[model samples]
Every structure is written in C-alpha cells, then in structure tokens.
Target: MFSYLVETGHTVEGAVKSLERKLADMKLQLLWKYDVTTKLFEQGIRLDQDYWILEVSHPDLTKKMLVQNQWSGFFLPCKMVVFSDRETGKTQVGILRPTSAFSHLEDPVLRDLASRLEEQLISVLNEIEQQQVV
Candidate 1:
C-alpha cells in the first residue's frame, strides 16, 4: 500500500499523545500539528470527526535528503495523521509510505533512506497500536 495505517485502542486525543511520545523516542520532532476538525469548524464547515495532521522530521535525516536531491525537500518533514475512523468510531494513525512517495525519483540512495525512515515510522505506529488508552 502507499500508506501504513493501524487502529489504536485509544481515543483521538490519547492516540495523539501516544504518538508524540513515540516520535520523541524515535528521535523525530513534531514540528507542527494541524487540527483539521477545528479548522473546518472555524470556516463554518462541520467535520464531526476529530482529525489531526502531524508534521514530523529528523533534522539530520532531512538535511541529508535535501543534500542528496534538492527536489526531495518537497517531501521533507513527513506527515502522519490521527483521526476518528468514521465507520468504526475508533482512532487510527497512519503515514504515507516514504518509499512509495519517493518512488518516482529513481535515486537508489534516496530510496534506501526512505525505506529506513519508513521502518522507523512503522515501528512508532505499531507501538501506538499496542498501547492501551490511559
């Protein structure tokens, strides 16, 4: 799949907190967070489900990527999302697979880097999935 998604046994808020902790453990920084639900509400569009987009990055990795191919900057500061699954009424966490996202670039080095990054991120998601709501 182009993305990696996993269901978590926590509410959206709980899941986000867990995610932040996991990102920290992996040495990734949470640079920004966008509350999609609140943004829509402010614009008078009701999005009943809670949804948040987190922008995360590893400074060293990002620098390396950009140095290898400036075009890779477009994919820097990768994104992960936490949201209420509409049908299941459960929380879900996911990330766009970096390897897939950079597949078109044809650079083997970048591809290897993305694969390693993707593995780290998937580990975070899996850890979150195994945690209980606290």
Candidate 2:
C-alpha cells in the first residue's frame, strides 16, 4: 500500500503530541508542521475537520540517502498526517510509506533503506494507536 494508517482513540492534538514524543524517542526530528485546516480557513475555505501534516526526518539516514543518490533528496523528510475522521469521530495518523515513495526510483538499495525507515515509522504509528486516550 502507498500509506500506513491507523485510527487512534485520542484526539487529533493528542495523536500529534504522541507522534512528536515517539519520533523523538526514535531519534527522528519533527521538522515542520502544517495546520491544513487553519490554512484553508485563512484562504476562506472551511474545512470542518482538523488536519495536520508533519514532516519528519532522521538526519543521519537522510544524509546517507542523499549522499548515495542526490535524487533521493526529493523524498527526504518523510511526511505523515494526523487528522480527524468526521465519519468515525476519531483521529487518524498515517504516513506515505517510504518504500512506496521510493519505488519510483527503482533502486534496490534505496528500496531496502526505505523498507527499514518504513518499519521505524510504522512502529511509531502503532505505538500512537496503542496509547490511552488522554
């Protein structure tokens, strides 16, 4: 699949905080956060649900990938989204699977690296899914 997603018992904010902690524990940096709902609102578009995009990266791994293939830098700093599911009244967190994202390159080594990264990212999402709602 192109993405790994999970429904969380927590609110969107709670899920985002949990993700921040999990990412830090795994030595991944949360580089940027885009509040999609707010942005849309500012543009006079009403998005009733909360949605956020988080950009995260492991410096060492990013450097290694870039060093090996400058083209890979295009995919640097993986993206994950935390959003509210209006239908279910639950929050969800998901990532664009690294392996799937890098598959376009068709490089075996990059694919292997992406697989490893995907595992770590999936672990983070799973941990968040397992957290108690707070």
Candidate 3:
C-alpha cells in the first residue's frame, strides 16, 4: 500500500467532510483519527488497497481547490503527503510511502497506480491550461 501525508491549516474535519463522498464514490474508505489532547487530526483515505493520508488544520480554500482540481501529480507512482499553506497559496506535496507500506503493492500495482494518476493529472492540467487560455 502506498501513502502520503497532506497538511492543511484548515479544519481537518471540514476537509474530511468534503472528501467523504468523493472517496466513497471512488470506492475508497476514509478513516479519521483525531487526538484532541494533542490537537492533531489525521484522516486516511483508502483506495484500491492503498492509503492516502491527509493531515490538515481548519478548511483551507486553496487546498480544497487543489483537491477539486484533481491533480494527478498529487497521486502518481507512490504515496505522498503535502503540507499546504493556504495563506501563501502555495502547495508542497511529496511522496512519503515507507518501505513497509509497499509490502502489499507489487510492480504491476505500482504501474497501474502511476498510470491512472498520470491520466488524471493530464486532464487537470489540460483544464487549467484551457482556463488560462480563456
């Protein structure tokens, strides 16, 4: 399984709420774990036997936009986590799949994941490019 951590200063709860139905539609399951004492929220989205973890604080509109954009760059090859700063309106998404996380994902699985991600990203970029042209 591959996994990543995406962080947003926005409400983690709100982000999870926004993603719940989409994940379900994609046949993914979302599990939320919050430690009030530590004021930490970690929500995991499981899709096709892989985990994509999003860590965020209140709902950041920018982060939401990225998710809505469905950027394939955010989901290719391996798992990743991003700590997004909505204030700066800049995003830094990264791969964070530990070696142990790959135990269940074979080469073919990796290729399939990367291919799907690439296709999705291409679509997103195309849309963005078109918007810019408009």
Per-model TM-score, in order, reads 0.97, 0.96, 0.32
Q: In model 2, what lDDT does residue 97 have?
A: 95
Off by over 4 Å in 1: none
Best lDDT among the predictions, by candidate number: 2
Cα-lDDT of candidate 3: 0.35
Residues 1-134 of candidate 2 have per-residue lDDT tens digits of 89999999988888888898999999999999999999999999999999999999988888878877889988988999999988987899999999998898888888988888999999999999988874
State model 2's lDDT. 0.92
Q: What are the per-residue Cα lDDT tens digits for candidate 3 across 12-117?
A: 3333344444334443333443333233332353222112244321123223333444442243223323333445533333333423332244444444444444
Give me the displacement of residue 102 in model 3, in angstroms: 6.9
**lDDT of every model, 2 decimals:** 0.91, 0.92, 0.35
| Model 2 bad stretches (over 4 Å) | none
* Candidate 3 positional error at 70, Å: 29
Deviation from native of the Cα of residue 25 in model 1, angstroms: 1.2
- Sort order, TM-score high to low: 1, 2, 3
Candidate 3 backbone overlaps, count: 12
Candidate 1: Cα lDDT at 112: 89
Residue 117 CA error for candidate 1 (Å)?
0.7
Backbone clashes for every candidate come to: 0, 0, 12
Cα lDDT of model 1 by residue, 1-134, tens digit:
89999999999988888889889999999999999999999999999899999998888878888898999987878889999999999999999889998887889999988998899999999999998665
- Order by lDDT, highest first: 2, 1, 3
